[model samples]
Target: MKVYLRQAAMAAGLLATAGLAGCVSAGSVQDPMSQPATLVPETKTGVVLDQLPPPARKLDVAVYSFPDLTGQNKPGENFAEFSRAVTQGGSAILIDVLTKAGGGRWFDVVERNELQALLQERQIIQNTRTAALGDQAPGLPPLRFAGISLQGGIVGYDSNETTGGLGARYLGIGGGTQYRHDIVTVALRAVSIQTGRVIASVTTTKTLYSVAVSGGAFHFVAVDKLLEIESGFTRNHPPTLAVREAIQLAVHALILEGVQNGSWSFADKKAGDAFIRSLETEGRAVIPVDALEPIAAAKPVNPPS
Candidate 1:
């Protein structure tokens, strides 16, 4: 009986290993090392942002800072990591999006994120000219001022909001998959530089996902002989990329809201109106339910009267 059980376990282990090998081999068929560097592909939100209609007049905008307000560290097991959960160069990403908005026709972005560095360079130039010409030196041109200022940051990050896994083993052979879901939220507001009032504000959320698949086996192949094997792979959605997508979506929503509220207008009125109507279904809102009638309190039961 023991001999038969050992044989069964060994056979099961071999079958499990073979099945996992087949799956892994499919992707390994390609020569990954030969792949060349290429431009990063656009996300869905980025594609829509690039396709937006041009505004009647580009708004002069400035982004002084966009920070990660979620102070959470990278998640791990049985260890502490000092690295943050998201990227630190959020302002750069936001500026890049703004510069590319409406095919570079929606915003006239100014350099406010590095204002000190710009001023210093300008001062150096002014000094050099004054010293070289002895009083006939021309003054540097005034920097462009922005009429609209963008303010916002990564407001929330929830790690492992949902997690699940499943697995089965018969005679010491098994395969399983595990998945986890995370969430990131961003808030953006366009403020009128002169009036100090928020022109348009938007909050956007994105879900990040990670999945892992693995197989392993342990069995006795012969008398006093034991064999074991393991194989696995993990796929994790990039947190920074998730942040970027959230920001892009926020920008798209902000533009649409601006149009809806008359804060801005598209160059082609008919096209703009049509586009807005098409996207109306994508907009979301939350409404609190009001009870039609209040429930009456239950009368206290009289004690055995």
Candidate 2:
């Protein structure tokens, strides 16, 4: 498998910078549609009402953190830079997609800054160890979140060249070339934050092209010519286009999972899918979920006595 070691490193760096305390604003409130029509279970007859996991007392959607891809070896400058760029771009894409799909108020995509502030106010840094045991853990809080999802990764490409000589070096001449392309795969995962269990995960790989050239003194000329040819292709097929496409695809997959799991409605699923499609087509990145009127908040249910 092709590896995007640098992209992974960049993702980690951006996550650190974004932190976990940003406050996402609810610009407008949207109306909540009626409960989803029931689904019939395969094993039974009558309709099965769509049941939501209990409404979380507090819903916090964490900004995704990419897995460390720095490996034992240090990454070079180009890889590091690419990794960071992709991570930031991917994270922004996920945030915008989720907010639009969840209708903003239904789910809170915690701004990194806001989350960081909350942690600081509570005096809880993720890496800090505490003396409290189990129930007494230092950062323990009763609030419950509906879910958390993370998405991102590195992207890469490669290519090659060859040489051949006429039998007995009859005016000795040699030449050959080949090209291969592939994009680094990115992963997206969704989990039930309260339970600390994954609900869904998806990985996508895109293609990138790379070409190599080789020969003799003539090889220099061939190499220079190849560079010009490749540069033209690269300029037209930039990594940003690939990253953006991957992000949109990943978000759409997540939305489908949310609907199937009862975390989101058909309406929400439709809206979310449409919004992302629009983003892909037009260059418009923002979706105004807050512009709609607020849906009535679900009343809390008491736990069984």
Candidate 3:
């Protein structure tokens, strides 16, 4: 009987060891590449606009293309969805400001249908011209555009924490606290279409916050229950309000830069600057002369008339 008992204990120990080994092996079999890698932090670099040459002449500008302004969400398992969202949000705000300030002079701001037709024609003409040039035809004129500028690009939403709480009674030891934080980042750029140069670029970050209970007992609760509590709390605090404000602030910065230079008018600049300052006490943006230099440099040494 003693021998039989010993044999049984040995078998149990062996089985336990095998089980642990199997688990480790399984974990090791997982592809490391399958997991998302940590992203590196972005370094802020000053734009060297001063290197550009002086503007030959401000051409009668038109909105050649506007960023995606519909705020339409892309549907798919691709980064394009996120990209579209940012692009649309930033574009909408930028266009509104530009239209109001443009005094109808800065850009043509063509309608969607008209813009599409023009683009199609431009493409066809470009193709024909290319072919003609390739064949050494006599009458092919080079394509000419007065100016081009990036109105805006991807401006992401901001995040913040709205509420937090602690519940010691839930756990046997110290109370647990719950916390929530919201985060968002937005990107925007202004470009000179004629020179194909980016005149201004801005990125903004916003943070919001909320806190709740934290404890080991909280983890033991049903997932659905925890989620329900979180949802109810979040319902009290929507995230977009702070984000919208942040976006407006960023837009204001870009407009201020445009106004400082002759690209945008002073009246619009004053109104925008005031609007931004009203939001925050110290809302100010200064564009160095150096920044504009690059735009000048990008122009052809002797552009065609």
**Which candidate should be chosen as best, given TM-score against the real structure?**
1
Order of quality (lDDT) = 1, 3, 2
Instruction: Give the alpha carbon lDDT tens digit for every residue of 1-305 in model 2.
Output: 13687888889888876663233223323323324457322210000111112223324566655442322222242554333323335566556545543234334676662466676755654234453454445554644433565544443322111222231211334434445444545667777656767766666555545454444322235644622221112122344455545555555555445444445443343444454445436553232334222221322222111
What digit string (tens of lDDT, one per residue) describes model 1 on residues 1-305?
Answer: 99999999999999999987676654364534345668656898888788788886788888999999999899886899889988888899899888887788888889999999999999999999999997999998788988889999999999999999999888899999999999999999999887888888999999999999999999898989999999999999998889989998888888866665567767776665555555554643111112101101122221110
lDDT of each: 0.80, 0.43, 0.45
Candidate 3 residue spans exceeding 4 A from truth: 1-108, 112-114, 117-148, 155-165, 170-177, 210-232, 235-243, 268-305
lDDT of each residue in 31-95, candidate 3, tens digit only: 34344556322111111111111223332333434343335453333445553323334344444
Q: Which scores greater on lDDT, model 1 or model 2? A: 1
| Model 2 TM-score relative to the real fold | 0.39
The alpha-carbon root-mean-square deviation between model 1 and the true structure, to one decimal in Å, is: 14.7
Model 3 TM-score (2 dp)? 0.39
lDDT score for candidate 1 against the true structure: 0.80
lDDT of candidate model 3 versus the reference: 0.45
RMSD per candidate (Å) reads 14.7, 20.5, 16.5
